[model samples]
Target: MTTPLPEQAKSIIKCCRNGQLAQLKELLSEGIDFQLFDSPLFAPLNTALKHGRWQIVRYLFKENNLPLNKKTPPIIAAAQYSKDNTTGLEIVFAHTGNTEAVDTQDRTALMTAALLGHEKKLTYLIKNATNVNATDHSGMSAFLDAVVNQSLKNCDTLLKNGADPHQITAQGDNAMTLLLQNSTPNPRLIKKLLQQQLDLNHKNNHGHTSLSISQSKHPKIYKVLQAHIEAEKQMELPIFAPSNPIEVAIQPEKNTIKQRPLNEEKTPTKSYSETADDRSSNQLQDTQSKQLSVELSSWFQAATSGNLGLLNKLKIQGLTVDEVDSKGCTALIHAAGSGNRAVASFLIQNQADIEHRSHNGSTALSSAIISNSKSVVDLLIKKQANPAAIGPGKYPYITLAAAQWNAGIVSILADAGAPVNTLDPSQLNLYHNVMLAAEYYSNIIKAKDTVRVIHHLGLDINQTDKEGNTPLHILCGAHKEKAYNADDSQIANLTHELLKLGALSNLTNKKGFTALQYAKKHHLLNTKGVIYSFMS
Candidate 1:
């Protein structure tokens, strides 16, 4: 039977796991050993690292000088445990300078990060000489991990960092075979591997080559592979071959050779026929192009004008509803943006792609939010549109709704599992959205409601952008001399709300300016006073 832990040990372990840094510090200062182990599992440093208690982990490392370069280092712990807390991983990397450290599973920090689709950590590791193609005990390479996880972005990153596409897994499946075997094969990824000139003829353990495996399951991929193989075969063949039996019969042994005229009579006839065929093909192509243009224009007009009958007729006439205009706006996108509920409904019912993004990355749901169409937004969400999808300018649908102050749309999206704390690719958070809303709308009521929604969702009020500026800093730095009239009371209320919601006052931007400093620099006495009161 396993022995039970003492109350003091349990308390210390609890503090580390729950991120109770102050409590942990108090316990450590008293009699609790900083190096106390929880038997066969973890030490205090490991416990803190495992739970992603970065503050506690840092304190133990800096104050106690706890070594991080163990058999299982804190870097691996941070890679495995730190989900959204990338700062902890960065700190561990900065302190240890060991990106290639492996854990008990023989998995390096880079492999762990790639397996979990941690792009930031993976990038850092790649930059620090960590091998991109390192495999774990299971013979799963970081590239294979990214492929199996279906993380296309990570796959691209690994490929760009020189991960071998031809590297086979333990099961004898290379990247191409594994990717093609996926239920929903990423065409882009497959094309990328194809461009790398992976061995299509290489068979797996199942004796299935890329062509043979994809022939039955993935016809599109099979066709692409087939065409490539045929082209390669053609390239391998000699350009000048015997055209007739007479030439073949008169081959190597004969000394005399008969030469044809440079300008044969049949050449002009063949050239004339080829030109006639080209003219016919061009005429047919022109006619088809004109017809397709007219059809697309009519389809777009029907969608934009909310003519359901005309849309139905066009669909009956074989017009693809999901086809985009020059701007990449599909019929559904047009209907959603125009607030034409009936037309949008018809398009959805007719199987229009709900998640189709425009050229600017705007989805149908985002367009509805932009048009302030609550019903259209609800319909799109009901049809299973991704509420967390980023649209034009890298703004999420929820952020766009917040910018419009459409509380109803925000609630709908939130209920549909839209993340309140959704960050952009550049790490812009809800705080950034609040600033964008204030700048774009300039409506005090809308600004207040945006803050209210953010608070209600319990998102990180203290979250900073890449520049390290919090929402408070952004609000304080707003130029009052801009186009809209500055509402002092509204600004004060927003600042007060941020402080009340635990927005840190001492946090500085990259330029070494706090919220109060920004306010003072802008000469906004009201904003400065509010911030000062909070600090005091």
Candidate 2:
């Protein structure tokens, strides 16, 4: 607002702000400089773009070769706000070299597109941007921004394109903690961090432990951490016990041995006192336990590898399909996790437990999501996979998928009548799918484009959460979140879309502030402008 506009640029700004297409055309005909770079906030070209005078934007682009500005780069602005104007953005991109221009928040154009779930711009920027790992003021890279935005594919793209997964935030949040904080800490995502050997032990300011930060909600992830701990524990003992307590190997009575003291002399020996018979018996028991472990372990291997022949042979040999491995993964769970639909179907036909939880509290349904196999997921949901049911049910998996705003699996679950109106552990209802995504959209998003694939329970566009936040209030940052506020630029664009969807602007939230009032209180000029335009 402090940026000054030239007298001629003022007339151009007025024409654009008022949507005066004819006047804007006349002004353009006079060969007046459209390169108003001095005051980016009040630049006539940017003003027209901001007000969404697309007819004027398109006309100007077609008729003139406008010079780019470092402060108010056309490509940056178009990528941030004008999502629908793809053609205009392409034209601007061709003329702009300022892809790395950071906003006041220190987020580059790439970061903004990544955070907004702007698929096209994100893809383009990932390939063209000089530094995908560039951090903002908060030490959050574009890859981190993409994770906060919750686009699994985009996160994958960034990671593959050399984005640093090891980067930590100002609050000491690493990749693992950020994913956990977003409430979508699925094992598949956590696996990537583990594979990179990223830190899971560092505590943020929240006073939570390595796994506690993740809410330790993901049982499979505990195994990732626990597996290492268990390995270290083995080094401390002669032979460590295996994890699966389900199959206890019965052993003959044997003499208990005690550690013997070793002399300090050069010829000292360390030994445990036990009868020869006892040692022999212990060896036999060890052999039996290893055999049992191997037999059970093969079941998981077979399930994961789609070895139908081995599975059928085991079934004929009287091994139950419900037999579990050390990790508590039944054959069905292994099959589902690996997306072996044929094997999953075979196990299910053989009466495999549909909701059987592994030792880590994971299930076939969650495993399917980890595989990203929509077909497997759809098949389980059709067989009555309860998403809200806890006690090792689907709640963890549901929370794992909480931030997947536009995932097709979400729609599949919704279509199958997943109990979305019910609250999850976070006290969020179905729309957390959208709300979680919006949480990272700091000054970004193409409202309808982002929310179009989302399914609302009973089509209640104005339904309130436990916090009494209607979608409008939440979209306008009327919720109780303290870490980040909704971006004013995003709120404006999203406000217009929500209004189109019949969001009630007059409705007050738990704190008694309507979306517009909340915007005004927060000094969200763009949000106010959009609401005012809608009202008018």
Candidate 3:
């Protein structure tokens, strides 16, 4: 049994936690034995770490060099904090060489990173975290948590790092079925996972295979699975389905130079990359797009400004209230986002679609909760909006509500029959929708970034696609694993192979940029080096 820490020890820890580095240093200079804590958490190092005092933590590690206790490993503590930076975590790796340290829950830092969708951190940790299949007390691995939370990049990282997605869930579900049970089925991610050779024939404990799970709920993913099965008989990897209104599909032919399991000398494991356009024509299109956005954005201006008279005028002018912008943003969505309760209520009263989804898959309710529009949220729920609707990052409406820190909204959603795991915050583990949605907005921010990947396999490195982008340009701005981009022989061998494939560094795309030029424009400096090294 642990004893209470002495007053002096507690004060030292307090200084560490509160970032009182000056006081901590003074106390340290006075020769205080900092290891007087009765518990691991009370230690100055962990206290500094838990509170994100990276400098103090670094100071202790560098000066005193205290042996780390497993009660809260540096990586695990870093993973726990949503805002922890790479430099803070680097302090740990610089001093110590182990990331496999486990917390009380048997959860490794990688699992916490994956559970929270810390893609960049997870990539760095993957090097030392060889136990990609490590599980928590609840038998949840990083792969399982990634799929359940719809952490696309984390899933890709775990898969690449040798996480066994085939590992059964506590509910006895395979990777495919488990993924279907949670997410809306990202057909792009689905095709990639299936291509990893997951079994479609494998059944869950409920006697349902991936085919059954996807066939009923996700017809697109079902088709993808069917296509894969067919392709298997012909022994070729299946290409993505055509673009649709619902699910975005993958096109593998975009960048397939050739497959060699080689990586760069640096091998920054966190692989994620470049874009170009006709200089004048592209500027003209961007201006037009902005003009069109302004025109469409005015659909909700009347509502947001609380000018019901203007709204009525727009209605009289044949502007349907439900009319959406190019991104499917409706007036109601706009009202909800702006927290204009009056307009939101008015729109709802006049037959606004409560559940209409924007191009990004967010609804009016999602916008409302994110904006802390408690009144609008209550109104939507009372009007019978689907409380269980999955929003951005594939999180539940209640889960998204929880992220806003609105107790009232969370309570309302819970009472509205939200399909959530728990209402009590204490019971909310990594798998809970509440925790899953914690990183929802962060994931969405990364969603817009084209995380380029240097493909291990390719058709012709010099081959030009319809966009006038050669394999090199696609290498500059391609999606690798999730929204994070990977690029040029950050896997060094792929770069050498790219050169052998006759990819001309000087060959320009429609944007009139060569491979090196494209990489420069896209800020793919690593790729620039790779292309430059192989240039004639």
The top-ranked prediction according to TM-score is: 1
Residues 1-536, model 3: lDDT tens digits: 77777776777888988999898887767665545533564567766766788888888887874445557777677667666356556777777777778888888877877777777778888767656788777778989877776777788666544567678776677767878876576666676566456889888778998999888888877887887674343222111111211221111111111122222254333422212334554677656554343334344445554667767766776667687755667778877766788888888888899888876677888777766678988988889998877665455665455443345676677678875442222222111221122221222222111111111212234555444655444445421213323333342233344555565768776767676665565566676777777763
lDDT of 1 by residue, 280-299 (tens): 86778766665565556657
Give the TM-scores of the predictions, in the order they appear.
0.45, 0.43, 0.39
RMSD of 3: 27.4
Worst 10 residues of 1 by lDDT: 246-255
lDDT of 2 by residue, 79-134 (tens): 66646245545555665545666766677877877778777778776556666788
Task: Flag regions of model 1 displaced more than 4 Å.
Answer: 1-288, 478-490, 500-512, 532-536
Residue pairs with colliding backbones in model 1 are none
Estimate candidate 3's alpha-carbon lDDT, on a 0 to 1 scale. 0.60
lDDT of all predictions: 0.69, 0.62, 0.60
Q: Score candidate 1 by TM-score against the native.
A: 0.45
Clashes of each: 0, 0, 23
Candidate 2 off by > 4 Å: 1-277, 294-319, 325-327, 358-362, 369-372, 384-403, 425-427, 440-457, 485-495, 517-529
| TM-score of candidate 2 to 2 decimals | 0.43
